[model samples]
Target: MKILIIEDEKDMLQNMQDTLVKQGYIVESASDLDSAISKVGVYDYDCILLDINLPDGSGMDILNFLKKNDKTEGVIIVSARNSLDDRIRGLNTGADDYIAKPFHMAELNARVKALLRRKNFEGSDLLKIGNLCIDSEKHTSTTQHGEMELNRKEFDILTYLATNQDRLVSKSALAEHVWGDHIDQADNFEFIYSQIKNLRKKLKEVKADIEIKAVYGIGYKLTLS
Candidate 1:
């Protein structure tokens, strides 16, 4: 999953990014409102951690922008304001959840997971397709045959492809989803192709029920075999 942390506090932002990275999420961050707005406008995210008090504008405006644009990314407001009106206002503004500062990272991670489940997996930790089961919480994929050992990018690629199973996913879309802002640094998709090749071999070894089929002019698709 990809997360955008919109926080002005340098230490706090770094801490949150680092924590999520360790949890196996692709993370990007911005410290001010403009940067935050730009990111939310362009990129797709599984979840967004927003700070209400930004350097230039209120995070409420960010929430409003997301709603106005009809973006469906799950948002959790992380703010210092603990007032009833603030909480009510945030929830009413279409935020999925709210967390106050001085919060534990573990609890924050838990809330993020819960929101992702509700948004992406229909409130389940396990995302299953055919015989393959992906424990998004544990970041593990397995089949009836056994566990499928995969690197971070490989697992992320499989998850992304599986999420859009049977649909032809463009290479740009897959690269952006898996690498976040870092994808801009790559000149071509050889890196992505390499990961998909490895994932396909692993699936074959486990005798999995799905296959990653490449489309010559476009990209790849995951189909049940």
Candidate 2:
């Protein structure tokens, strides 16, 4: 999973990034509104942890930008502003959840996981495709025959493809989602192909019901048998 943390406090931002990264998410940050808007425009994230107050403008406005752009990334308002009106406005404006400042990191992590589960798997932790089952939280998958474990990048690739399902995911989008900042440094898609190849082999080894089908000259799609 990938997360973008939009927070102004340096300590808080670093803390959130560290915690989420430890929890196995690709995390990035923006300390102000402009940077946040720019990042949101260029990249897609599984979840965005947004602080209501920023150095430049209200995070509420960024919510509008996200909605207008039709980005499906889940938003969780993490604000020191504990006003009911602020909470209502954030949710009304399209936030998936809200967290007040001085909150426990455990609670924040739980909310993020719950939001991802709801967004990606329709409120279920288990992503079921035919006889195959994937549990994102546990980072494991299983078939009728047995269970399988994928490395970080391979698991990320599988999760990204599963989120898009049958939709053809372009190489650029897949790279951004899985590789994040490192995607810019990669001169070619050799890494993506390598990871997908490994992931495919593992799925086949486990007798998975789904396949990652390449759409020659375009992208790859997740197809169920």
TM for every model, in the order presented, reads 0.94, 0.97
Best by TM-score: 2
Candidate 2 Cα RMSD (Å): 1.0
- Could you tell me the lDDT of residue 165 within candidate 1? 89
Error of 1 at 39 (Å): 0.9
TM-score of 2: 0.97
Q: Tell me how many clashing residue pairs each candidate has.
A: 0, 0
- Which lDDT tens digits does candidate 1 get at residues 1-225? 899999999999988998999888989998999999899888889899999999899999999999999999899999999898999999999899999998999999999999989887889988888889988877889998999998888888998888888999999889999988778678888888899889999998888899999998689999999
Which residue window of length 10 is worst by lDDT in model 2? 181-190
Task: Give the RMSD in angstroms, all C-alphas superposed, for model 1.
Answer: 1.4
